[model samples]
Target: MSSSIYSTRRWRKLRAAKLALQPLCEPCSRRGKLVPAYSVDHIKAIAAGGDPYPALDGLMSMCVSCHSIKTNARDNPHAFGKGWKAAFKGCDLDGRPLDPDHPFLASSEG
Candidate 1:
């Protein structure tokens, strides 16, 4: 059994809608990978004062692997150590970084 919030019909509908909207994992897609998403995560955690049911844009679709990585990094930072943020390695077909937070994606001033 999961938490009450997760078991609610509203939450279920929202999760389903989000998954339908983005069947592929957002992070994986950014990495140029075509992995199916198995989870719908809140962009801002409800425990952190985020809306319990925000718009679709406020949610993220993620595969089990990406979801676990994000959850661990956010909920158990100490356990993951200092280098937890950039846990994903390797590059896309264009040689661009696979990690969404990679410096290559950052805006560079001319």
Candidate 2:
């Protein structure tokens, strides 16, 4: 079952609009894949102090698999470990990490 916030009409409309704006899974696309989006996810989770109704850029379109992986990593960190966000296997064509949140990229930012 989804959270009560997700069941709200406002959230539903935002979700639809996000999907329409970005039909492809954002993470998969970054990895050079062309997977269709199955859900809209908040880039910054509400529980983490993100705005519930943030702008389109604050949302991400994700396929079911990616969504599940991200959710498990974020919501169940104890079971999956803190590194779960970078757990997606394989790399892009240029040998770059598929996960944008990979530590390699984070380190490079500075």
Candidate 3:
């Protein structure tokens, strides 16, 4: 989150365009929710060697709550760590959709 890159007109336009293109919280979508997204996030953050201005593939739209949680987790990896993966364990090995009664679904039900 460099100030210089974030302040550019190009970044602003891209953010707006991305939000319009996919107006749903990406993380929520994967979990079968329909939250509207208002912020664009980088899948690979700039601090993690991602491009300062990445393309659509590296970007996602997210709601304020989702954004805050993700940012907080990322900012403090040790506390949150990689526990986020547990949330996605509902998917198949390759992240494919599984049967409704799939055992993995139980992990997310609680």
Candidate 4:
């Protein structure tokens, strides 16, 4: 279908998921914290030489600061994307949580 249409649908689903996961931020849950999630994360970013698709399962709800820090971690390692941090803060989990959208959406289209 059309790319823009796809983008719109993707955005809606992502936003819906974020709203549903409110008060249970994935990033925080992973860290053993229970805080309201506000920001969505992209497993791969547009600037990382990847596709321009909205993150699906990769779209995790986190605080604004956590989201920024995660993005920074993806962009830079030693500082934020270090070893274990890279594993948690870097890439998205495998196997899509929902059948409609994979748990982890790759920034790359292919």
Q: TM per model?
A: 0.72, 0.74, 0.72, 0.48
Show model 1 residue runs off by greater than 4 Å: 1-3, 80-84, 88-110
C-alpha lDDT (0 to 100) for residue 85 of candidate 4: 54
Better of 1 and 3 by TM-score: 3
Tens digit of per-residue lDDT, candidate 3, span 7-108 = 899999989888878989877787778999988987666876878778875687888877776777667777463434444345544585432223554355
Evaluate candidate 4 by giving its C-alpha RMSD to the native, one decimal: 7.8
Which candidate comes out best when scored by TM-score? 2
- C-alpha RMSD of each candidate structure in angstroms: 5.2, 4.0, 8.0, 7.8
lDDT over C-alpha atoms for residue 54 of model 3: 82
Whole-model alpha-carbon lDDT for candidate 1: 0.76
User: What tens-digit string does per-residue lDDT give for candidate 4 at 1-110?
Assistant: 32353358666676676658564667556556677777655544445543545545545567766666665755566675353254354332442232112234333346
For model 2, the superposed segments whose C-alpha errors exceed 4 Å read 79-83, 87-110
Order the candidates by TM-score, highest first. 2, 3, 1, 4
Supply the global lDDT for candidate 4. Answer: 0.53
User: lDDT values of the candidates?
Assistant: 0.76, 0.79, 0.70, 0.53
**RMSD in Å for model 1:** 5.2
For 37-79, candidate 1 gives per-residue lDDT tens digits of 9999886678767777879977889999888887787778585
Between candidates 1 and 4, the one scoring higher on TM-score is 1
